[model samples]
Structure formats: structure tokens, C-alpha cells
Target: MMKLFHSPTSPYVRKVMACVLLRGLQGKVELVPTSPMQNPGDLQAANPLGKIPCLVTEDGTAIYDSPVICEYLDGLGNAAPLFPAPGPARIASLTLQALADGIADAAVARQQGRAQQEEAGPTPRQAAFQERQLAAIRRGLAALEASPPAALAEIGAVAAACALGYLDLRLPELGWRATHPKLAAWLASVEASPALSRTLPPTA
Candidate 1:
């Protein structure tokens, strides 16, 4: 069986877990809970970047970052590919994934900044940086609303769902749903997937 370094609240890990479910390979992959903030030695060795969602193959080969791991899993079975094959569809899906991932990154930055601010009130410059992150997230949400993915079964849709999920978990004050009704509706539909529901981040 393959081993997956995971975090209960990491949207990236949730993305990979969704792929595992989509491919119907849940039994083949073992989820080992982990955290990058704690800097676990094993996770660091498996992925030099010390990131969660790293997959260690049965033969001890380690694969990293959610996108790479998802593609690797896609090759393991005959299930429909979440990532489209080389062409325009592939380009569009990958681009959507990148944009969604960027949104998640911005959310993370803002949350971390907020935490720092709580610990030691942020300087004006730091507060401005955090606001910038929030602005980027809003812009990304608008772009997604303008051109939502056609299918929830694709990588692009999966990524967009994960990004919105992260925002809901960490930045509910953003009130994204009120501004991007299309994107919110799209996400509500995507959440109907068993893969997504089963991997939702733990509230605690």
C-alpha cells in the first residue's frame, strides 16, 4: 500500500484524498496524519519541502505537492482521468487548478498574518500585506464566478472546490458567497461528491 502524509485541515491533503476516492483506490492508500508546522522528521525526509499530502509509494519513492500526487494516482488505475490529456482541455484544467491553488495560498497567508497580528499587533505594513492577500482572494473568486468549470468531476473543479472550502474554514468573514453567487452555487453542487464530503476538514 502507498502511504500519504496528511493533515486533517489541509485543503491540499483533502484534494489528494478526493483523487484517491475518485480513482476508487482508497484501500490502496494509507493516510498518515501529519503537520508541516510541527516539522515532523519523516515528512521532511519524504518531501524535502516538508509539505503535507506527500505520497510515499510502496517501493519507497516519494511524490509531492497535491497536483503531482493527483496525477500519479491517476496513472494507477483505469478510472477516468481528473486531469485531461495534453491539449486545450488539459491547458484549461491545469490553469484553473493553478488559479485555485493561488487562492488557497493567499488565504493561508492572510490567516498566518492574522495569527501573528493577534500575537503581536501587526505593523501598518504587515496589515496592508494581509489586506492585499484578501484582495487577491476576492479577485480570484470573481474570475472563477465568471467562468466556472463545466464539470465537477475534473481537476479544475476539484481544485476550485478545495480553495473555497479552505476559505470557509479559515476566512468566513470574507463572505465570498454574497459576492460570487455563481461560484458559491457551483461549490455547493461540488460538495455533493462523496469524495469531497468524506475528506472535509475536521472543525476541531
Candidate 2:
């Protein structure tokens, strides 16, 4: 069996968990709740970056970062493929994945910055940094609004759902759903999928 360092509220970890469920690997993988900020020694031992969603394979080969882990899981089961084959479709899926991941990245950074600001008060540099993150999130939302994914059938769609879920979790003040109705509708349509529903980021 494999072991995964995990956190219930991390978008990246949630992404990996969704993929695990989609690929029917849940029983085969152990979820070890981890706090990366606390820098647990075992998590560091498996992944130098000390990130959650780090997968330690049966033989102890560690795989990391959510995208790589999802791709790895895609190879292990008979379930429909999340990743597309080598072709234009694959490229499109990958590009979409990148865009979705970029949104998740910016949103996470912006949330962290907000937490820091609450403790230390906002500085000009931090405020500028946060504005840049916010801009990236808005642009990503617009792009997806123009062309939302087709449910959670592929890696890109799964990623988009996870990203938007994060927004609902940590940045509800963004009011993204009102501004990106199409994307919001798309997400609403798929949020009930077994993979997505089961892996939802924790509210607390």
C-alpha cells in the first residue's frame, strides 16, 4: 500500500484525494494527516519540500506535488483516464490543468498573505503582492468562464473544480461565482460527483 501525507483543507491535497477516489485507489493508499507548516520529520523524510499529498509508494519511492501524484495514480487503475493520451487533446488538458493550478496557487498565496496581514498588519509590499495574486485569480476565472471544462471527466476539469472549491473555502469574499456565472454553473453541475463530493476541502 502507498502512504500519502495529507491535509483536509489543502486544495492540492484535496486534488490528490479526488484523483485517488476517481482511480479507485483510496483503499490502497493510506492518508496521513500532515501539517506542512509544522514541518513534520516524516513528511520531510519522504519529501524534502515537506509538502502534503506526497505519496510514498509501496517500496518507499516518494512522489510529490499534486499534478505528478495525480498522473501517477492515473496509471494504477482500470478507471477511465484522467490524463489524455499524447495528442492535441492531451495538450489542451495539460494547458487547462496549468491554468487551474495557477489559480489555486495564487489563491493559496493570497490566503496566506491575508493571514499574515491579520497578525502583522498589511505593508505596502505585502499589499502589492496580494494584488498580483488577486489579478491572476480573476484572469483565470475569466478564462474558465469563457470556456468551462466538460464536467469532471478529465484532469483539467478535476483541477478546475478543486481550484474553484478552494475559492469557496478560503476566499468567499472574492464573490467569484457572481462574476463568473458560467464557471459557477459548471462547478455547480459537477460538485456532486463522487470524486469531488468526497474530497471537498474542510470548512473548519
Candidate 1, residue 128: Cα displacement in angstroms equals: 1.5
Question: lDDT of all the models against the reference?
Answer: 0.90, 0.91
- What is candidate 1's TM-score against the reference? 0.97
Error of 2 at 75 (Å): 0.6
In model 1, what lDDT does residue 180 have? Answer: 92
lDDT of 2 by residue, 1-204 (tens): 999998898888888899999898879999898989998999999999877779999999999989999999999989999999999999999899999989999998998999999999999999999999999999999999999999687999988999999999989998999999999889989998999999888787
lDDT of 2: 0.91
Give a tens-digit lDDT track for model 1, residues 1-204: 999998878888888999999999999998898968999999999999998889999999999989999999989887899988899999999999999999999998998899999999879989999989988998899899999877777888888888889998998888899989888888887787898899888776
What is residue 28's positional error in candidate 1, in angstroms?
0.7
TM-score of each: 0.97, 0.97
